[model samples]
Target chain A: MSSNPQLRRAVTPWGSFSWGYSDVGADIFIGLGLVLAYAAGASNFAFLFAGLVYVCIGLAYTELAAAYPVAGGGQYFVLRGLGDLFGFIAGWAVLLDFTIDITLFAWSSVDYMSQLLPAVLASVHPWSHFLVVLGLIGLLCLLNVIGVRESTAFQGSVAAVDVLSETLILCFGFLFAFQPQILIHTMHVSWPSMFGLMQGTSLAIVSFVGLESISQAAQETQRPASVIPRTSVVLILTILIYAVGYSNLALGMQMWHPVHDAHGHAIAFWQLFPGNGDNQGKAVALLSAQIPYYGLLAQFYVPILGAILLLISANSGVFGSSRIAYSMSTSKLLPSVFQRIHARFRTPAASILTFCGLAVVVLIFAALPQLDHGARAVYQRLFHGEDGITFLGDLYAFGAATSYSFVFVALVALRLFDPMTPRKFKIPFNIPMRVRGERVEFPIIAVIGFIGIFSILVFTLITHDIGRVAGPGWLILGVFLYFLYRRNKKLPLFRSQPHDWRTAQTSILKNAGELELMDEYHANLRASDERKRALR
Target chain B: MIRLRTGFYFLYVALGTIILVRVLSFGVRFETITGIVLGILLIALGIYRLFQVTRVRTSKR
Candidate 1:
């Protein structure tokens, strides 16, 4: 094999990505906005701090991803850079994050549509949200089956609109007032309430979920190296739009306070919009217009633009997720049959079906009346508990955190053990000696990600009444399945290797026709790019 | 699309759609079997996916 630097460069700047993944920053805002807008009962300093932490983590990931551009997905990189267990966790987290995000977006779309076409669409078809979300999923799946370009176009179009709206919010929100008295002096954070704030921040963090969207799109990028950094810059800009713009808006509104009636029963206005000087009234009016009643054209557009931003974010989710379905299906994790690309589209048909299908399921679940906050912390009100907060399924916070945390630890461990690995962009870890920062010690940053992720997992899972065994329980299941599947397949692959479609294909080819699908696929790819690049 | 009891698949997809809507309505769980059952369901779905793959390939090309 020729030791061409071009081959080496194939990892980062030399890398390629799908465009759908590249544009996820736009959608991430929507995820964050939905969580921030609908669920801001607390001022989560931990989350804000975590966002600060993720910026470093994001840089670390960018460096590593750029250095090793062809590393594929988050789980794929973690598996290589971290180790088996951590990789599994990363993959699981990425999958879980994507899944939760899809569900949430579908739910949001239902709410948005309800606001828009609330006539026959809402009444005659009470179950219309289910159909609408399902249809949307179907449409996206069809797009994927058609081609990567189409999907990326979808992501790009949505994101372009989002950028315009976010610009409006940032421009206007700053103009409305920094409100230092309200900003700094509204500092009434209780210990328990602080934890609640973290949860809201977690939602803010959700806006960043589609960071993977760009990574996934690496294959389709014109210049993967240039694309990744450019994407990172744009992402930072968007985060500012969300963090500074939205956080200040929430703060200015005195949204942290309780709403009172003539009867003095305190009500909270989460779903309700921002208020006037009442904060509640103005926010509401702002929500109604996406235009501020009190501020400039840009200021007026902040709330309206926020919603528009979220809608765009949701659209990105729709776009990126279908590709994941295609990737997963192509790998045979779902079924090779689903792996078939459309003749002209070069997209996976079955994968698209799986993507949309799962999304619709989650949407319907989200729309359940029990999930909506009616009266009753406990008793009578369906799906209600003694506390007004509906926990919504087995979604333990720790599970979400652990998946990514392991990846962090894995990155650190890999750097220590494998010092000479090649990379495109290494993070600037200030470690004296040891190649003098030539190699970015990503482990430090990933370690931070690890701690933050693990902390969320521990605090939420341990504190919440999820069950005696549920916290450790999901973990045990991941382990048991690992062994059970291993035993059944018995290929002697390394420990904790996730048996997704790509890995399975790699294994099949390595074994030289031992795996049936690999044999067929290899035959088909007689002159494929990978084949041409192989040990000639 | 090679039909495979389209109604059954429809029913299956619809079943998941309907049940997922009410999944949270289940009062707090008291056992490990819930997640375990989910695992089993996942396995079953995986298997069904494999079957669909085989059928789609055999008929398509």
Candidate 2:
């Protein structure tokens, strides 16, 4: 094996799986709340729907990551399969989700804490809630600036504990409280309209959004081709089961303790839960408290566990957004200011500051009342619980669905255009096609994935009331910046470099032990370059 | 390797058939157009995989 200093792949398969596993911690805490807010009695169907889509996307990501392992997640995959323009769009969308991830996690962390102490709940007066969220973000930014990486042992321990605790809670909860007849009755009574179901499905996609961290760890893992497929498949299945099971269990509990209306009448939990935002943000902890034997366990255990996991997730988002911005700058898609490092801490201080600023702006936007009553009315009509956290959720769903759709498209295109790239695992049920005498396989999985993801993207536009506007607003800004950067660099606005594709292919092949193919490709590339120089 | 490839082809066919039967039995409601489209796509893919199996057998001969 050729020993390059930067090519040290040390992570095992378990390690690779753990990388993605840790990132999924706080998704349960936040996602259940948002889905219940929209789908109410049909939250299980929403999760099941989104989980199927997640399965398809996960397989697509596995195929792409195995073929072209890299660190930039979906952004890098789309960049290579599609060109720079689509690449920029995908990356920009991911950046939006990351910013929201930070804001939402910080706000939810405080929400969980508020369940423990009434003083924290009372902090929502005036600017106090906003100040607390900002303070949390600031603290995380400071810690990142000081270069505090979570120890691998810490990540592993938290992931294990969280998984075990959640499983026990679900198992015991269902054994005690689950009734088939009650679930059926709830589903019949609270069956959502098609539009509402689609909206809930879109929000449910946010629960599995951060699993791309698995694909992003491709280059760092030993034997990525073999490891990625196993890890990603398992990861997708685990998250799917958890999301669907928890949503269904929560619905059963809601049936037992139906929320009462003002006239002392029983009503759906979603209607009253979102009223004044009491239970809107902290839905999961409240659900845990309703579990039969485990009700007492939740009072002491759930709040602290939730707070810790959410804080970690928020910390990850702060650092992740800055890193992605720095990468975009390095690739000349953004201004050089983002690439500036702090002299003292050697961190991307400017990028961190910029993303934190964007998060602050988003928080303020959601906090402030919309000047246009028309806009607020439309938002309320489409979605329940119109608050800062839900607004953040709308953007998160939009960003996640949009970028993931691009990944699906990229996976299909690559399978068609770049076959023979060693894939230890491909999405099952591919059809062979001879495209211009090249043996290419068509990815049926990616096609289904694209259909699912694109539908969600459309639903986000129609259902997310606020997201439809804000998501496009962010994309427009990105396009403008992309063009400005290109003009300043004297590069063509949409031209792709042939060298990049060849280099990415060669690097992936070399790692897969297809060194002979790598050498032949390099030799041909060199000969072609020499011929061009000779012609010149 | 040949048996493995053939098995995979058969596997695809089985999966496609199952999806089609399940979806068609579920009733073709206006809201379930998405499911119908998916079933059709899977069937097409399955037939194509069968063709791939034939290709592999022919090459061996």
Candidate 3:
């Protein structure tokens, strides 16, 4: 083994953006259908509300990632700003999201591919579908354990094509098929009930999932502080546009293919895609396939494209989970076993295997409702008929909401305490203040983001019966393990271990090859020290 | 490749302008406002990309 181990800084600016894009951008493929089903005419509104909160969260992440440039992402920030306990909780919650990302996207990828191969459809051939998802997960795990450079190049190219294709679909969709009158009419007539709107908004947050990929990939990114802000802001806006644009277009567009309701009545295009078992998972492909003349070609390629994108997203989960586990283990939050890197491959093989195994476990649990008649009956009776992709979505929303709530608080806390870290990107609308003889900027947007994300967490608990039980159960299990591990190591359970953050920051900056940032950080420390001496 | 990339940015600028004009021509209301925001964002993004390209070229020179 090498004496000193480190993640190579090879991810360029575009690679960094594509890393985040391939993960988060794939969400709309699944999210659009779920939001449409629940939020109905108010799907646009749900997306709008969630998109706004996402912008806030994105801004906070950009600021923090640029400052820290670490692999643990929200977990690392929370550990620095809050204490070890809260950081562990955040990390644990993020781990749940990452694991679910693997299963959810893998399952949905198969669903999209099933558009081309109807026999493997999850709704029809449950076992075959389950096996396919398992196979994909295994393949992704092997690919990650071997190396990431090749996969990153593949991810970037796929992301570029998908982006171009989506833009073209939207342009053609709006130009030929979209009607403002239809959208307004739908909103007026088919606006969802209060509970439905709440549920839809909660699910809409799924479209903004995988923002953590930005910060997660930061450890391997070249000049992260400079690149992250530009890429992240664009990513945020691009996603927001796609989410709102697609929802509006779906509601307003004239149907290219004739759709029928349950009673054999003809219905709008939006009415056909949602609630339909076959269409829900491959909604983006269906949406693209309805775009005027483009539909002719899109019908063939969009499904293939969607499947590839979703698989890439699933691969991102494998990459993210292992890296986060590695980071956590390095900080002594997890067992040292998780920190083991393969001597030849130089990858976190243990973390990849363990988390990927957990993903398999999650996939099995999600598949329980689909596996047998008795299990299906029990799940339906107990969890309000939520299973399959919906089950995965519920857990995903819960994990993301839980971790994001902590991240906002961490952003605020970091702003207050660690003013010495030179933040290249600061969340706008800050109220500068002096607290306990320290200069601090009270981030107003972070508070708003906290309220928004916390409400979504409450919404997830209130609306998702399965998620309400399973999500907290996951956290409780994690906390128990944390206590046992800490006790075994003779470490403080509640209190944070003493850490010299200045020295750590210097090392991090030096390793990242950011001498200029290190100098600026030193200057800030010197200035702060002088001020303290003057005060004394 | 650089020219193609610049062309894509130009397309973005045009697309954003078209969307903005089309939405505004329909008259501003609750339903159309989101489109307005999206159009504005797209335009800004295109401008930013173009600016970045110019800056890079100038730095190289």
Candidate 4:
């Protein structure tokens, strides 16, 4: 951190991994509830499908992050590789996801805690779920503005506990309570149509969305070229196993029973979980309490732990968005106001306040259905009754799919344009392509990743009625703002400066801080020179 | 020096083995397959590390 609100390279490999892990916090707790609502017993397969794409996207990010090693994550990669216009688009899309991350995680944190504390649950009554979620977002925003550092130790501890607890629950639940035959039968019996499965898979992409934090910390990581690859592999595996395993386990437990009213009339679970259109985000707590030996642990520990982890994630989102906004401001992609630091706290107060304000706007649209007659019916009809959390998931999926597709493309462009730049690690299975007297290796993994993620984007458009409208609206507005910024700066909006590997190399070298690492690199270069001399 | 190095290696192996045995025996009774698999992986890694330590020692000699 700097007085001017710049990112610093202080994160170790484990710290980087913990940051990614914790930012993804309790996604399973919320994800299981959402995916099950759509795909029913086939939720496991949905997660499995999304998890496969996540693996591709994760590897693609690792390759890009290692090569560029910048703070803006995908935004910087796309900027250097593609150009400023596309870069702004990518950064703006990610901003959308980060804002949603802040609000959604905060809302779900209270939703999880409400299972334990009746008082917090009661707050959902008066002004609807709006007041509580807004309060949490405001609290997180204020914390960020005041420059409260989220301790890496706290992140690591929470990540370790969550992983261990979930692993235990999965293993015991699978061994004792999970019936493979029953899971298979349920998958068959409640198996959705292809259309339904597609929708569920698109939504399931939300579970792995926050893993991009690993790459976002690339500039902050020690030995990022090696560290990102190591940390991201473990990060991907952890999320993959949990997402797929939990979905199957939830289905096995038959946790999707329809809610019954006080008079015992059957109502849909999604309808009355919060009655006035909010999601039942505490389904994971309830599901855990149903697990045999884990029931007691789930009753006391799960709700509280789940709440803390979600709040941590919400806090990370605020930090992530402000940092990205700061980086963009430095690049001249955003208004210079976003770059302004608080005189007292040395934090990006402008970016924090603006993004939180945007989140508050989204919360209002989500609660539109709770309004009086004319507007209520209109909102329901237009957005299709998507609660705030579910609405956030829709936009998250959209943002993830959009930015990831661009990143995959950026990976290919960087490989082609900067062919001589040293890549410590490359995505597996590259095919050589000769263009303009230069041989560039095109990654087969990135190609597949682009296709898979693009398809998810398309399906997300087709399936999420609200996201299809709102997501494009956000991008169009971003494009409009980008052009305005370019015109004001007297810079070309569409055209960009020619690709220069020297500039890219300079960025990498400027960010490289470790003496031992520099020593090792120089030694390796010297050895290469010696080998050439010997051959001559 | 060789004795001290080998002692640390042996200690590492012993710790890993204890984890392995506990996970296999107790984890099975508790029906946690994840613990058993994770424990076995740790033990294999420990043994590999031990071999590397001894190999380095012998080569130095």
Candidate 5:
């Protein structure tokens, strides 16, 4: 094997779409239930609010990923635009999300499987469920270390089936059980308090969390400049529709299962979904199982499908964490050990094992209350109630909100600073301006996106008892490690090292086999240089 | 590949139209506003995709 083995450009357009769909789409399976539990009747509004902001973030990603098609994603974009310190922070926050993703989806996967096998339900058999989650994480880590990858065809087929199934659920629910008056009445009567709304909106962003997958896979995508924009736009729309549709359907539909209150009286469907822990993680499966005629067949397959999708998502978490660490290592933000691939496996063994270990530690931390009576007492006293999945969800939302806020800022900064890179797609509604005699299209949407995500961050801090404490704690630990590593390596701690990004962009485009974009970049550089010389 | 791309674009267009018709059939209400907005966005996206596909085909020809 060659010493310098580059990632092959093998991911086609459908592959790119499936890569993103499998990650972002799986979030709703868990997120819908969480939002419904907290947001209640206003769940649709929560999804809409976050979905709009997500659209802005998605657009920013599309522009950046197309212009600078690399595997590093938001971290690379931030490093290019905002300097090293902010880049490390963004990457670290993303790393937090990736770790949470591993444990959270693994836990949810088991919960989905528990739909068929009641023995593994996390709510009832916490220890057993925790053990299963650990086993799954270990399995994923092993598979990743051995460099096992699912084919694009398989992934696409799954995504297609999921999309069709979800659409059918929505269609059938609307046709048979849905009533607009019921939806309006629920929204009016069961509307959550301000704090609940804030928390729900914050949680709603989880449904849109994995947009980074597309940008991460951009480097390996064929004609990423064109394909990324197309796939990303479609992905953004698809996720938005599902989130909004599912929330609306949940509120409007008639109850299919007998939900009982404390007095054994019948309760509403919305009340039952969020109230039950098992149903919350596998909400989509339950929702699908309630759709009249479709429900008959869907009841059998949806849980299995949800479990498969959730497992795939958890595996992505393992894949993503190692890849981001590898990127950070190559950029000198992380220790070189992270970048070192195993001789035989030809994968980043250290990074995979290390992050996977951190994920297990996170799982343990989340499951502490569930595992021990003493810990449960402490958690109940301090944090009100202890739900492992909610704890993980809090951290996931916190990480995504924090990283995405920085990404919005990075988008604006890049538009201002990196004017020479050809952007095939730009976020709509930009204001034309000149900065230091260079023309810049100030991204208005990015500012809006920043405000929206920052608000979610604030909401996460305010509402999530465990997340507010643990999320910042994780960042603090990362910063401390960063300081130590930087000092030991004799690198600047706060400041960025000088990087020739123009040449880097050229190299990236060349490696992606984007000769047209490469030529466009060179031409822009030459024109800018000529103008500079003329001015001199 | 082109046929697959075209099929996807057509599907999006059809999906968008279905969403719009379905939502609008319920009439305009505060509760359904999100559906309306999403439907419009989907239609716009579908149209944009179709336009892009056409432009690429024409350029290739």
Candidate 6:
């Protein structure tokens, strides 16, 4: 790692700290937090805990990211900090994270649109909405290929809109029209319902997923060490933001009950206004649910505007994953094809297009006639009552949880094993009954990361509507995929071998002491870079 | 490349703010004591990780 510490910078750090912050946004999971807060019937405590888990993990990653701050977030970290096998698992887990990150947003975006265009979208006739979603994806991809400036400019604008719209909504939400009675009545504490909190963790986890940008953005930032430290601070800020917004959203929905688990915490948001909530004025009903609990005119159109802003924010989530992938590709972990720079636009065209394309597929399925169609009926029944889009998102969340567990373990293990490695930045902690110089103890952050992720994963494993068969089944598929990738490529059987006492004492340290580790590693990498440039 | 960086930054944040504001505002009677405890726990954890830095790095694996 010392030999090639800056490899990530070449692929990731765009330039400096300014560039890192300016470029990065939260991930698809954040979007999931919004949708899931409602989906899980999240109350203030639920969102708070869920949000805390996210920010806490973000803090873990924040420190790890500063230490490693490579292209692959958890995957890259595990490989280096742990071993190759766990690294492989981390990589596979990220695939789950990336794929579902794209799919979930695409589906939810389509769902939002369905309310606006029911006949064309909800009727499932010609499936015109599907095509439109696909086309829109293609356009995003094209734009990604066309130029970075275009992509960033558009996402930034919509991001601003997201912040602004929500601010108005929250202000209205906590205002006079907010009747505390309804929320107080619904605040039921049950062990059974805490399962909802576990399920909701998936949503909360979703919001923090985008913090990968901290690693991805390290390349572009002016000061990797300084900026990385601040990213943790920003994560704390983000938690406050999510906790408040989601809690009030739940409170705002006191006027009505959701369609059971069908509506979840999202129903809380949908319940802002008092009315029949019939399917007919559903769009108006959905929008009306947003009638600000504040002033007279505030109730008129603020919710509608906020919804629009959220949908726009969803698009940026797609953009976030695409950009990260592009950076990865350029680093050579992903195919060079994904690394293709729009000759004119100076952006990774192929990666962006792929992201947009997949999103449209999800949108089409989520919106329009198909979900209600007979085949769709059977499919939904076979899976459960929910559409594939939603379940798939849950599956994504499950994969995300499992994968995150690996990260926490890796962090703790690394702290135990490599107790005193040099890193550009460090997180602070204090320990009880410890030596004077050492106020804090080892793996404290690691312990926090482990506890939070483990508790959530335990809850997720137990309580969710995830198919008992499907959840583990997905992991089976992942294992099979790993084996297949291995057998075919003859890559490695022990994806990661345990480093025993002798191995760690001798081989590992011997290798670590290699005189020209960085020089050799970078030289080899530069050769590959030349080859790529030649091909280009 | 540039768009993914700077443009998307504002774009994504602009989008996230809605979720952020909403989540934060949903009033809950939080156990303030609990929160303070958690915050302190985090600070302690932070300081601990920093301490590991000053330890003996040249020690054998």
Chain A TM-score, each candidate: 0.70, 0.87, 0.98, 0.89, 0.97, 0.70
Point out the worst 10-residue segment of candidate 3 chain A by lDDT.
A1-10
Return the lDDT, model 3, position A211.
78
Question: lDDT tens string, model 1, A1-536?
Answer: 11111111122321222233333333333333334442353332433554555565566556544433432356655666554555544554455455545555444444444444557343235456456655655655555455554444444554555444554443343344323234333333212255445444443444445556555555445455445765564364445334433443444333323457678875433334211111221232233233243343433444333333334444444444444444433332223454455554444445456656755664554444334434333334433231211232224243345555655655565455444433345555545334322333434566566667566555455434532234356556655654554466552335544544345434523332224434444553453434446735
TM-score of 1: 0.64
Query: What global local distance difference test value does model 3 have?
Result: 0.89
Per-model TM values vs. the true structure? 0.64, 0.79, 0.97, 0.83, 0.94, 0.66
The reply for model 1, stretches above 4 Å from the true place, is A1-47, A83-86, A118-126, A189-194, A253-343, A369-400, A417-421, A432-443, A462-484, A493-536, B1-61
Q: How displaced is residue A138 in candidate 5, in Å?
A: 1.3
Write candidate 6's Cα lDDT for A18-104 as tens digits.
Answer: 222222222321333333333333434555665666666676677776655344666656665667666666655555455555555
How would you encode candidate 4's per-residue C-alpha lDDT over A386-455 as one tens digit per residue? 6666788899889989998998899888888766555677788989897544567989898888999999
CAPRI band for model 2: incorrect
lDDT of 5 at A328: 85
Tell me how each candidate scores on DockQ against the true complex. 0.01, 0.04, 0.54, 0.06, 0.46, 0.05
> Candidates ranked by lDDT, best first?
3, 5, 4, 2, 6, 1
Q: State the TM-score of candidate 3 restricted to chain B.
A: 0.92
Model 6's CAPRI class is incorrect
Fnat of candidate 1, please? 0.00
lDDT at residue A261 of model 1 (Cα atoms)? 64
Model 2 regions more than 4 Å off: A1-15, A146-152, A219-223, A254-261, A265-276, A336-349, A370-385, A507-536, B1-61
Top candidate on lDDT is: 3
Name the docking class for model 5.
acceptable
Instruction: Kindly list the per-residue Cα lDDT of model 2 for residues A1-536, writing each as its tens digit.
Output: 11112323545676666667766657878888888877877777777778789889888888787766665678877877787888889989989988998888888887887888757553345266667778888887777676523333455667667766676566555557655445556677887888878878888888887766666557556667667887786677566656765776666544445557789998744454533454767777777776777777876788877777777777667656766666566566678776676665556777777888888888777665433456556556765437777788899999999999999888877777666455667788989887644567888888888898898899889987679888999999999989998988887798864446676678676775556556666775676567658767
DockQ of 6: 0.05
**For model 4, how does the per-residue alpha-carbon lDDT over B1-61 read when each residue is reduced to its tens digit?**
5565455445434533543464454335322343333344334544654675688787998
**C-alpha lDDT of residue A78 in model 2:** 81
Candidate 1's displacement at residue A499, Å, is 14
Q: For model 6, what is the alpha-carbon lDDT of residue A503?
A: 30
As for TM-score, the candidate ahead, 1 or 5, is 5
Report, for every candidate in turn, its global Cα lDDT versus the true structure.
0.43, 0.71, 0.89, 0.73, 0.85, 0.47
- Tell me, by DockQ, which candidate is best: 3
lDDT of 2 at A383: 56
